[model samples]
Target: MTAEFAVALPSVILLLALLLAGSAAGVTQLRVEEAARGGARALARGAAVGEVGDIVRRLAGETARSEVALDGEWGRVTVTGRVPGAVGTLVPWVLSATAWARPEAPGAAIQPAVDGTSREARLGT
Candidate 1:
């Protein structure tokens, strides 16, 4: 019995450690995805190019690094992030996540047009 237990113990420990590592990786992936989503949304909303990058970097923080790309003509934003992990033996692993969103065009926003006289009446001064 002792011999069998000794043989199995290492395997069990390794399995548990791998499971924990996998869980940590999954959590990090979630954070990466969230950061990507936030970046895409910011870009979609017409944030400046530099500001979009800043927002993505801040959202990713130290655990991850992110990049944001924008397509002004198509109103599209893409965000990518890499998540780092140590699965075993102090070796690092990287997981990546990406998100995209398209912003509505300016022409889509409808507003009531008012001529000078109507504008004055609406002001009701």
Candidate 2:
């Protein structure tokens, strides 16, 4: 019984370490994705490029980086960051996410729906 217990202990510890590493990687990826989305939203709202980058870094981490690309009326943001943990040390896991949004024209008014319903009508006001 002692021999079997000793043999299983290392395996359990290793498995727990792997699980913790995987959880960390997943959380990091989620942070990267949220950062990309926030950056994209800021860009679409006509924020400056520097502001967008700051938003991304704040949402993700100081080590995270962002890229912005604009084509016509659309804006795109990509956020990348290193996964933090044993997994990253062993495998160099780099997680990234991209988000796209259409920039609203400066001072553009909100257009009514295609059906021509006004806000007051929809709200029963």
Q: Estimate every model's Cα lDDT from 0 to 1.
A: 0.54, 0.76
Displacement of residue 119 (Cα, Å) in model 2 is 37
**Model 2 — TM-score against the truth?**
0.81
Candidate with top lDDT is 2
Off by over 4 Å in 1: 75-85, 88-91, 105-125
- Give the count of colliding residue pairs in each prediction: 0, 0
Lowest summed-lDDT stretch of 10 residues in model 2? 116-125
Most TM-score-accurate candidate? 2
Pairs of residues at least 3 apart in sequence or in different chains that clash in candidate 1:
none
* RMSD per model, one decimal: 12.9, 12.4
* Model 2: residues with Cα > 4 Å off, grouped in runs: 106-125
Structural similarity to truth (TM-score) of each candidate: 0.64, 0.81
lDDT of 1 by residue, 20-120 (tens): 88777677667667766776676567665455556656666653455444333332333333434455336556666667666646543211112322211
